[model samples]
Target: MKDFFVSLLFFGLTGYFIYLIVQNMPQLFTETTTIKQYGLLVYRLIMVFVLFNLGIVSSKNYKRSKPA
Candidate 1:
């Protein structure tokens, strides 16, 4: 059950991140002279952080739960 919930949360966060990127496609691509580039960079950085943290946590839990 714990693993199920954790996976669900991870997927939810990832889906939300994708949604944000897709929704901002216009501002991220259309504004060649605007400052929206910074926002896109920040969003990508956040997605990387989320994916990294999820991997770290899942691995830690797997290691702890494994039998010697």
Candidate 2:
């Protein structure tokens, strides 16, 4: 039960973060130079990677806490 809640919380926060980024995407792209666009692309990729790894680690820990 606790593990389920923890995973839910993590995903919920991740979703919210993504939502915020998407909501601000137009502002980020409006009249931006090529360099600035590339920078935002890289930044978004890093954020996704970090969030994916966080979910993976959280699941691993949750599994480890359970016995066979």
Candidate 3:
């Protein structure tokens, strides 16, 4: 149960970090409006895919604790 919760916390943080990165992208890099929009779209898609992989890893790692 503890391990499961810890993984859930990390998953949430990963998503929030992705959001923060996308929102502050304009300050990080300067580009034309059209290019910037396309770049963000690509970045979001990639990050979402990465999140899916994290889910897979978390699922594989979770083990039910046996009673003492």
The numbered model that scores best in TM-score is 2
Ranking by lDDT: 2, 1, 3
**Per-residue CA lDDT of candidate 3, range 4-47, in tens?**
76668667866875786778677654554577666876777677
In model 3, the Cα lDDT at residue 56 comes to: 55
RMSD to the hidden true structure, all candidates? 3.5, 3.4, 5.2
Worst 10 residues of 3 by lDDT: 59-68
Residues 1-68, candidate 2, lDDT per residue (tens digit)?
57656776767767766876687677665565477665766776677667766776787788888888
For residue 67, what is the lDDT in candidate 1? 73
Clashing pairs in 2: none
Model 1 ranges off by over 4 Å: 52-68
Worst ten in a row by lDDT for model 1: 27-36
lDDT (Cα, 0-100) at 37 in candidate 2: 68
Answer with 1 or 3, whichever has the higher lDDT. Answer: 1
**Candidate 1 lDDT (Cα, 0 to 1):** 0.68
Clashes of each: 0, 0, 0
